[model samples]
Target: MMLKLRVDNQEIEAREGKTLLQACLDNQIYVPNLCYLEDMESPSASCRMCFVEIEGTPQPVPSCTVQVKNDMVVKTDTPAVRQLQRTALRLLLSVHDVDCKNCHANKKCELQNIAKFLKVGLKPKRLERYLKETLIDETHPFLIHYPNRCVLCGKCVHICRGKHGESVLTFARRGFDTIISTYSATDESSLTCGDCDTCVKACPVGALAVKESS
Candidate 1:
């Protein structure tokens, strides 16, 4: 059954089981999100950029993880929501490569786009930028994985797991030193990047890409 909900003072028709993010997007509403994929379960709500104010909630909640309900009231552009999003985005940018001009993703990058949407500069404002050692894995024949460009959204990991039975791309390490990785390989034959580009297509940012043949 279709449900009616109020989003930012606009009444929108959303389906019974759709998420708040899905409902908002279906209505052409713009919500800054980096971790929600359409066909996949939110494997990790690590991005923390989709916060919205729901009626009766003391704290802003991530919209991607909330289901839409009849008569539900949601405020997407509230001061609290903006603050949460701004802080989350600044943190993401702080550790990001921030080399947009030479980066392959460039104009098509989600991080860049969301930053623009939020009116936040890519340069670290109140926070200091932390640059980790560049990790480029070209072991796979068809693709290159740049850990620096990744936002840890897990889109690539979910796509790999969804398309195939196993997930080759995965999160490694913990806390401030965390990163994404695949199974370690003793030789080139052990690498499992497969021929499909599902992960690349699913990636909101251009962190993963096709390796040009030499």
Candidate 2:
């Protein structure tokens, strides 16, 4: 079934049960997001960048978590929506290492694109920047993890699980110290990440990369 809705004053049709974010993106309406993936059965809504104002809602809601409804009305460019997106971007930047020139993602980084879309600078003016002391984790045989550069969006984990039935990547620690950790491979035969770059490709930031050969 197809549902008709008005977004930014333009009529659009979305399949029933499709997320508002997916619907908008399908219609060429850009809503900044990072944590969302099309294959995800349940949206984490972790990025908090895709907020939209529904006509009857008191406040903006994350579009990735809302299903489209017939006759629904949405405004993506309202002051409240922009403010929420900017604030979320700034929060992500506070813990982010903004050395784009040296980063793997660089020009193609989602954080850079989202910052550009939200008109928020990569550096947070009011928020104190915090970074993990451990810059790199070399535990994984085929991959390197950068804690400072990660946005904790969990796309890599989700993709890894989807590809391999179970994920070798898992989040460890809590709060400001959280980082992606890999399960220790008992032996060469026990490793499952062999030649699999799904997690690396799924990372929106340059947090995961192929390690240089020794």
Candidate 3:
């Protein structure tokens, strides 16, 4: 069955029961999303980039987690939506080091595109940028981790547990002390990881990365 929805003041249709993000993509709405990798079965809802306004709702909701309904009205690019998106982008950028000029993801990063779209201004709050030692796993031979760039979005853990049947990676500690590391005291290099790379691909902010093959 097909469902009709209003997005960005335009009427669009998509398959019923599919997620709003799927509906928007089907209709070319092009919502920016970080926690929603198209091929990944997991929906982490951590990045909050795919937020959209619905008629009669008080605040914008995550499109990736919302299901489409017939006659529903959705607003993806309204002024309020834009402002919220800008704020969200600013928050994500706040924790990240925006060294795009020299970073590997430079021109190709999704967060960079969102930053450009949001036209992020100088942050209202200032703090020291903490840089952690990058986590490297020689046992996997295909992955790299820069915890400083990680936004704690949990996409990697979701991918590992959801798609690979491996629960090797988990977040430890709490609050500002939280970091993505392997279960218990073992490191990623020592864990019997399958090296699926799903976690690397699911990361929205370049936290987990792939080493270019030589």
Q: Rate the local accuracy (lDDT) of all candidates.
A: 0.83, 0.91, 0.72
Ranking by lDDT: 2, 1, 3
Highest TM-score: give the candidate number. 2
Poorest lDDT segment (10 consecutive residues) of candidate 2: 183-192
User: Which structure is stronger by TM-score: 2 or 3?
Assistant: 2
lDDT computed for candidate 1:
0.83
Compose the digit string of candidate 3's lDDT tens values, residues 156-182. 777777765666668878875677875
Candidate 3, residue 64: Cα displacement in angstroms equals 2.2
Model 2, runs deviating above 4 Å = none
Q: Candidates 1 and 3: which is better by lDDT? A: 1
Error of 2 at 139 (Å): 1.0
- Residues 84-170 of candidate 2: C-alpha lDDT, one tens digit per residue: 999999999999998999998999999999998888899989999999998988877778889999999999989988888888888
* Lowest lDDT block of 10, candidate 3: 131-140
List per-candidate RMSD values in Å. Answer: 1.8, 1.2, 3.5
lDDT of 3: 0.72
- As a TM-score, model 1 comes out at 0.93
RMSD of 1: 1.8
